[model samples]
Target: MRTFTVEIEKDEKFYIAQCVEHSNCFTQGKTIEEAIHNIKEVIDLILHIKRPKLHIILKDSLVNAL
Candidate 1:
């Protein structure tokens, strides 16, 4: 599993979570725990799927290229 940095910011009533490596990846929740959980799930979904920008290799479809 790859490691990612999660930054949390409080905005009045919600906690916003953002990935340091990905500017477009962000989410918000009512609490710190909820924000963390939301961000975790978001990261998983982002990493597991193909991205148009980076063309990231799908985690579930990786293959040996040797």
Candidate 2:
């Protein structure tokens, strides 16, 4: 499993979320909670598109995969 850092900032009418590890990856939403959720989707999409061959076991992220 891979771990990445995310940063969130408030800008006008939305909360902007950005991946610290990926400068071009970012998303915004109406609320902080929505921003967090939207950022996850953006990150997931970026990972899938950029690392198509990457493999991960969802259930064993830290305890077992570490």
| Residue pairs clashing, model 1 | none
| lDDT, candidate 1, 1-66, per-residue tens | 356676776767887878778877778889767877777777768766332222222122112311
* Candidate 2 lDDT tens digits, 11-36: 65776777777888788889666876
Runs with alpha carbons beyond 4 Å of true place in candidate 1: 49-66
lDDT (C-alpha) at residue 63 in model 2: 27
Q: lDDT (0-100) at residue 11 of candidate 1?
A: 69
User: Which pairs of residues collide in candidate 2?
Assistant: none
TM-score of 2: 0.67
True lDDT of residue 62, candidate 1 = 19
lDDT of 1 at 27: 89
